[model samples]
Target: METISKIELRNLQIEDYLELRASMIEAYSGIEDAPWKEHEIKKLLSIFPQGQLVVLADEKVVGCALSLIIDDKDIDDNHTYEEITGNYTFSTHNPSGDIMYGIDVFIHPKYRGLRLGRRLYDKRKELAEQLNIKAIMFAGRIPNYSKYAEEISPKQYIEKVRMKELFDPVLAFQLSNDFHVKKIMKNYLEGDTHSLDYAVLMEWNNIYYDKSPKLINSEKSIVRLGLIQWQMRPLKNLDALFEQAEFFIDAVSGYGSDFALFPELFTAPLMADYNHLNEADAIRELAKYTEPIYQKFQEFAISYNINIITGSMPNIIDGNLYNCGFLCKRDGSSEMYTKIHITPNEVAHWGMKGGDVIKTFDTDCGKIGIIICYDVEFPELSRLMADEGMQILFVPFLTDTQNGYTRVKSCAQARAIENECYVAIAGCVGNLPRVNNMDIQYAQAAVLTPSDFAFPNNGIKAEATPNTEMTLLVDVNIDLLKELHEHGSVRILKDRRTDLYEIKKK
Candidate 1:
């Protein structure tokens, strides 16, 4: 047998109950008039096993610390220990509480000089910090008070302890650990002789606590989006395309959407090459109107005080043709992301070249990325965006058949799940009969989310009917994404085996 003196602190387990209960009895001795039942201890562990911890020395249980979460609003200055703890049952445990209430802590009498209590308190502080709560609050027993109960009041006795005129085994240790006395709690523990049934309220604030209430509740942090499944047709002139753009913007801006997204090549109708030019010639003609179309969308975004993702458009940059997506901010600023993955049709028929950079946009709504049509079909692109802190991805696509649309739709949902992010897709649903190579269209628009408890059942925040020309609006909570990454049922990001494999960009 190994006789080494090794100590370990860890979360309470079901099998540790017998040893833990025995340690509790030895630690409390004559002071524990109301000892905890074994079933009650099991119940506390079942409620929140993370808050209950035990310390072991040489593989033997020697100390334990039990705690429960409580809402700060429910705690008043005059609350007693029993009132806060639900008569020692810990039925008041609130998972969303802002404060961690220490229910009980004890070290076996034989293990008292080993500083085992400090290890238990340290573990509690670590747990509280991991939960991102505001503070750790508990009532401290003044064990030395039995000698002073006849000589001084609870308040006076606490003042003497604070002033260093008297020493309490518990309060003095708590004070040494940076906890401050708040107030006196009377009759905190029933039939307690050491404390005279009085306890002192003590608290230790977590200085690094997150102050944003939005993180705990999704309702407080909403990012509304307007997704437009554009209706396409042959444009009689440039004015016709401008009219359609203005209408969609006016409709969604009234509903107070932070962003309005349009479909890929939404301005393809502007080519109006009634002469029936070939695919390459028609795409080249559309490229000519890119500057004018961008100006118009920029004006619309500023006028309505809404950010606009002007889907994708054909652009001729430095004599090279590329598919580019533009984001026009309400502040009159704009950024562009070119499609890095060019489709076979684009390359073979239009001589389109793929872009070289993969980038994300930082906007008022959130960190966002744009992946055009076929770009989203590749998981690496979305993964890179997510690695860069992108919480939302906008995919603008143009599909000519139901099969093509299904490919994009299914891939979009998978990207949402794999990256734990929101994905909003928009596409053109009608055809420009007069324009060659653009006469057929099949599309749908949808706001997809990660398939997690914090999101919708099907991971679809909102979706337009397939092959329909309509607008869909939905609210996505960015804070919910933050919470999911931290405390979701499965923490994919945190659980990645970086030591075995890694993903990086050259």
Candidate 2:
């Protein structure tokens, strides 16, 4: 059965979030903190049901405008994004509030340039008039501000936009609707690279309203992790290898993925540059390129707007060589994780040592943990990560045979179920000729969730073809993990008997 395409406007239902999410992913590609999570939407609807609305096309969610009635006393004249909506928990929403505050609005990219946004705005205005609000206020994002950020100040750029000399998609439309800038606020929406995290506190005074107040930007953070099941091949120089990695990062960014996972020792293919030396010296020589490659991946993370897990690399610290990797976050911050359970071959061939820490790292969405290759086989590290509140565990591995790959895969799934968290494992496939101790690999990259009604019955959300060189993009809801921890059929986390035995940190 085929449905006819027709545009319709109505109040947003809780069920509309999934469709709205896909539309939102397309609308804000290469932008972080773009899509709103279901729980946040539920909070808004429960707090102020009439303020949330949606636009549907042929029964598909294509556009939406979310809002809440708030009091100005709870918000300040110089408010940051966090202070406005009570850190996106929407705690500031008050039923007897004196102002009409807009939290979010966007149209599907495919349906853009058709004034759909204008229609949504008109509906919001009607609702404001109907309720008799004081005015409509929004901390509207300046999306185009980043283009000329180096050449012009934010205030000057806003002036140019207001003067009609320069056009800003959000601000221009807002200006047409009689909204004027209260002021330009800094770091209004954190990690909004396009806006340099700057936004205008805009307001359109209501003439027909008798009473009702204040809102800034509100974006819900969820993670879509994209894993690169890499193919081991020869590259002549560092530039070629970096170019290849950036290609995958670009592809992942286009999908609006929050993080990109690369396989363990994916950089091992570069060891060919020093293949003339003995195995230990050669791998150590490969370590020389680690810093440069990490620096380049950091640029990719920021420029492409995706966090990058630089699969395992060789790190020589204080004369001790370690199997290590780095997490290059999109917000220009980074973290490092080393393999805590180095394989026997690594110790024999490259003198690799296990790293000490098993800590959780924070991302824009939530806390995450990283383990390399053999680390997953040891349950203690993962338990330590889980104890530290890690929601997603990233495992970057290199396996030489089907048996090796199975060990990592099975253990990863077990970790997900037992820890009550998501686990994403990636590895290199094919062969890297002429590079000692890195000659062959077999991989089946996948993201595994806990076995629960909300998750897959078998616990695998997405996986790539065995031994294939491809990208596996999967969207895992952080809320699902939260739900599993709180109300799943088997509460693995809650059921752990610490009194019997426990794994304590040294």
Candidate 3:
């Protein structure tokens, strides 16, 4: 005897007919049967290839299961196997049928005693769930019934098997696999003497069936994004920052936005009075308010019932200055992502260093990635987040010129297309006349989507007036991203040449 190395179950293909036919012939060798022609198998495949399946061990076809879809209402009260299936021609396969009718399950003689039948049944159940059908139904053979046909009727024989007082090589196996006997059928098969031409109608209901398009595109499947175009004004103190933050929170939460985002270093206004200090000292002064800002945002998130990505704040942790963004959840819990890419101005002027770790945050809406300003300019950072199952990318940026703003905007749009994910960018606008290194700001808040028919014409779902002090809110459908990855005109995520090159994160 040889051991099975690996088993693979897949949809039936026309090329599998030769091996499947041979297996069917061998499995029904000593029983009365009509051989299935090649055209019949091809017809079945042409109608619904998903309903037919084959199991392979080391590339050898050892088991097969065939099925067809049918409407339950069309099945008559006293339907025979031939009447229900059109004498095995399968011309009755209804594409919109709610019930999946299992036509046959056969295992090669050499593959017997290996529990291959169980594998075939499991595959059928999987197909039912994928199609979101009502139930799996078929007429099961009572193979050992011929021996006891004179002792009892078919219904009585089935009851004994159900009661465990008798054994049915076929019905017992079907029952163990959760198929309940609905009733007995007479003359179910044309030439089945072993079963005395009697079979049991069986069904396995799919209790978890769901097939509504609204359910797929519901609010449960969307992530509402709120982008804040912060006004670059002089901040007298942290109270001024609080006033502006509360205003945006109140405005966006009124519309039920899930995540509210602010611009990078939006809290820099809090250090407006310390502008007389050197550039490095002034940024460090902003860092001192990081703890208080984090605590305030945490409270705001709970009070407004929204998750707040408080943009990027300067943090002087362990004597090293880093740009960090906090994601405060509605429950008052928060996490932070440090900017992994530092700009030339950041390093030369503010003595800022880049972070080492790249991560994504899990929320009620979806998995999100927070990348700040220049970090979005690097493709690998967004790719890493996408690989980690980030369906939405949030960028909090601060740029003083239109050229710098374009860099962030273009890269953000490109990332959305490449990864097939939503990207929301928020930035600061207006002139902070007194704050060094942040005196001038050029900003626009926009929600960018992949370039597809399901999306907007310019790949932007929503945007604020350039350099305006306003909040932009947009609802992004995560399901649309899923559909694009599967059925878009150009599936960038699925068409990646992983064999040629891969994105490996260290």
TM-score for predicted model 2 compared with the true structure: 0.61
Model 1 bad stretches (over 4 Å): 1-220
Cα lDDT of model 1 by residue, 4-95, tens digit:
23456688888988888788888888864545677888888889888988888667887788899999998887777778878777878899
Error of 3 at 162 (Å): 65
lDDT of 2 by residue, 241-338 (tens): 99899899989877878899999889887888788999999888888999999888876775566789999889889988988899997655788988
State each model's CA lDDT, in order. 0.84, 0.85, 0.85
Clashing residue pairs in all predictions, respectively, total 0, 5, 0
Report the error of model 2 at residue 487, Å. Answer: 1.6
Candidate 1, clashing residue pairs?
none
Candidate 2 RMSD to the real structure: 16.0
- Candidate 3 residue pairs that clash: none
**lDDT at 300, model 2:** 72
For model 3, what is the C-alpha lDDT against the true structure? 0.85
Compared to the true structure, candidate 1 yields what TM-score? 0.57
